[model samples]
Target: MTPETSAKLAETVDNCRRHAGDWELGITLMLRTHVTIDLTGGLPSVDADLAELHEIADRVGDRWTRAQVASAAGEVALSRGRYDWARAEYEECLRLAREVGAHTEVPFAIARIAESAFCSGDFDGAEQLLAEVAREVEPYGGVYDVRAYGGMLAALLALVRGDLERARAECELARAASEMIAAPPQLTAGLDNIDAVLTARAHGPEVGLAKLGPTLAAAVAAHCAERVLASLCDTAAVLLAAAGRSAEAVRVLAAATAWRAGHPRSVPEQAAVGGLPDGTRAVLGPDRYEQEAAAGAELSPAEVVTLLTGS
Candidate 1:
């Protein structure tokens, strides 16, 4: 949706929420929609709605909505690269969901925890969690986010293991599932990341950058999650380095690193895929790489976009 439409919808929802006031169910639904709308635009100010939603759920004694609030909070944390905290929130969400006998919510909660694990470099744990998620979700055709992220995680794990064939197959599954579900841009960005890396591995870094460039631009334009933007920058750094653009690569890597640093406990993608390659540093040597990286660290997100897109 266009930014204009999204803004209008957000305004309308706020109006409805004011009118609904203190009506637990109506407020809950409105808050859910509000959160979705905000996240779709990659805005970072959903805490107020989430806090209010939690208060209502507590007042109403609704375990299911409580579980949902936990999941939503977890998503915010995850988007900021707070993997440990995100996992903790997801675990709470899972416990609450199971307590309420929310079968559908269970798989998605598990998928989210798996995503946290994957981002934190726990591929084995992520694999086990995703396997459990698949067992629960596949029989019932799976929920949108669950299928999309699960497939993407599986593909990423395959790539890490040097199993290109498996990676290709899983990436295809992720893309198809995302398309079928009409995935939100944030979810689509994750899938596109896998594709860009796969393209780079199969062809060359330049080809991979070609695939990644448009995806990165679209992601920035869509206001995807901060994690999405960081991951794209991470990929761009690696690909640019491989393609002989060492200075640009170092700068981009520095920006991505700076973002994670801002979050304190934030973790990047798996070190193998996301961290700047040592080879690139060796080529540039300490002095030049450090100079470029230091400059990159000072760049704002918009500046990073300009550095990348030249716009």
Candidate 2:
């Protein structure tokens, strides 16, 4: 993690530690910090902290707060690429939300589950969950994040299914919903909008590459390591391939591979694709890198872009 991120997390942790009486608020703070860390491709220490916090919430018997904590944990796990654990956490959160009738939390938990499924290549399951969330949350007023999230998921699924037209439409909807939110741009709502725009262009590597330059620049300026690494890996792979810079693509992939090695406990479904280089694996081990190297079949430039961007 960056120094700034570490300091921010430390502040949150200190506040939570000092204010133990406010278990709900403390858990929320921890969850927010955990989410930010997970999204930025940080170290594994935060996951351990979140697990401890989860135990505390369970002991306190705060069902609603526990549900939110679980949902946030699941999201962080998903961001780290831990699909199985993420799915389990999301399922637990969903059950708790149902028991407590916490309508606001249910959609978010379901959306996280959908994301897990999508990352695991279970498009049908992902689509079903997203559709359910959209239906369930529609009657509840002011759930713009849910709506935009579902649209973003729909766009990804459509793109994977080779329905470019449908993907484009969903991206437009996501962008529109994002515009209505008053929250900070780094928040989930705004990020979903940015994701939609980038995913739409992912149909063509050239277009995606052109868009990624500015997007990565912004993410770097904001100190969003996960977003920057993701954009770099995807854009570099594709642009290099398109320009016949195979060696450069290999170099970018190597760097991404190294980053993943440092966060082995992270959610595997969300990590970069194409696995580590052979030398990296000799140092990091095969289990740390999910994908195996192919001898002759290199991914097309667009496919490389999709793998990196999760589009």
lDDT at position 230, candidate 2: 53
Against the true structure, whose lDDT is highest? 1
Angstrom error at residue 163, model 2: 0.8
Structural similarity to truth (TM-score) of each candidate: 0.84, 0.73
Please provide, for model 1 over 1-311, each residue's C-alpha lDDT reduced to its tens digit, 9 standing for 90 to 100.
Answer: 46686587567666765765545443555455434533433434666676776677677677777777777778777766678888998999999999988888889889889889877878789889989999988677757667777888889888777898998898898888787776878677777888888899889998888777778778767766566677788888888888889888989888876765565333335464444646667888988888998999887666776776677
Q: Kindly list the per-residue Cα lDDT of model 2 for residues 1-311, writing each as its tens digit.
A: 46785688677777767765557445656655555664454545566667766777867777877776777677667656778888998999999999999888789788888988887878899999988988888788778877777777788677667787887788778767766785333443334434534553565545655565455544545545453355355445545455444544554564454555444422222333344244445543565433433311244323444544456
Query: Please, what is the whole-model Cα lDDT of each candidate in the order they appear?
Result: 0.75, 0.61
Alpha-carbon error at 66 in model 2, in Å? 1.7
Residue 112 error for model 1, in Å? 0.7
